[model samples]
Structures are given as C-alpha cells and as structure tokens.
Target: MADASLFEVDTDELRRVGNTMVGIGDDVAEVARTAPMDGRGEWGHQGLAGAGDRFGARYRYLIEQLAEDVDRGGVSLRGSANAYEEMDAINAASIAGLGMDW
Candidate 1:
C-alpha cells in the first residue's frame, strides 16, 4: 500500500468529479420524475396489473433512494475538496512562517 503521507490530491480534479457526479444524480432524478413506473391500466389482466403496480412502486422507491445517495456522495466529495484545499493552504502558511518557501 502507498504511504498516506505521500498521497497527493488534485483539488480541481476532485471538484470536476464531484460536479459530474452531481450532474449524473440530477439526471437520474429527472428520470425518476419523468418516467414513473405506474403500470396500472396497461396490463390486460387484473393480477398482472396489480403485480406491475407493485413492481413499479418498488422501482420508484429504489430509484429515488439511489438518486439521493448519489447526490449526497457528490456533495461529500465537493466538501472534501474544499477541506483539502483549506488544509493545504494552512500547511503552506505554516511552512512559510518557518522562513521557508512552500
């Protein structure tokens, strides 16, 4: 395993990735909003219609949950980038205070 101290983070890259994740989450949410899986009157048989409705409800619930989770992940990633950037700034300031150029 690589040493933790040697790890490097690209804040810009993190922000970009976070933004992409957010976009994907938004797209997923749009899908859930636009394509509701309510197969009530479509099925010919009553039993099949009921089953389809149940499945549709479950699918909508799961998709909504997934969208929320993904959005949270993206937000977390963006927050992490900000935290890392701040930490880097503090470290550089500390280094500069020691009569050194960082």
Candidate 2:
C-alpha cells in the first residue's frame, strides 16, 4: 500500500518531497555517524520533521529517532554508522532513480 502511494503521487511533487526527505535523512545520518554519543541528538532534523506526512515530511525522523535512542543507551553504536550510511545511500539512490526533472 505504501509503495503504491509512492508510485502514484504526482511525480514532480513526490520527487520534491522525497528528495528533501532523503536530504534530511542523509544529513542526519552523517551527523549521527560522527557525532559524540551524547551529541547525536543534536542532529534532530528527522524527529522534528516527523509530524507531517511521514513518508513525505517525517520520513527522516525514523533515522533521527534511532540515533537518539541509540545515544540514550537504547542501542549500541558499534555498527550504527554503517547502518546510517546504508540508509542514506539507499534513500539517495531511490530519489535519484526517480529521475525527477525538477
């Protein structure tokens, strides 16, 4: 159902929304990857953006929230950076693959 919506929305708009979401996610991932354990939450763009259309505006929050939880002792950071990087790479590719003219 969700994937269907992603493919069905107005392409230009969805591309814009998706690209922005991915950018935010990427930025959070980079910051979280290098951030000190305590400073990880500073990169809160994703969580802060989690109120709107989730997949549209709140998509990045999933990544941000994870970083926050990890910093709060909810998860280990040993391989966190790799995970975040993978997420960014995957999302960026998805956005670019759309070949949005905008």
Which candidate wins on TM-score?
1
- lDDT per residue for candidate 2 within 12-87, as digits (tens), equals 4434454555555556666645423333335477564443334432445566776455443322232333354455
Tens-digit lDDT track for model 1 on 1-88?
Answer: 1111123787777788899988999888877775454547876888988887787778878888889899988988899888887777
lDDT of residue 10 for candidate 1: 73
Q: RMSDs, each prediction?
A: 4.1, 18.9
Reference-based TM-score, model 1? 0.82
Candidate 2: C-alpha lDDT: 0.46
TM-score of each: 0.82, 0.28
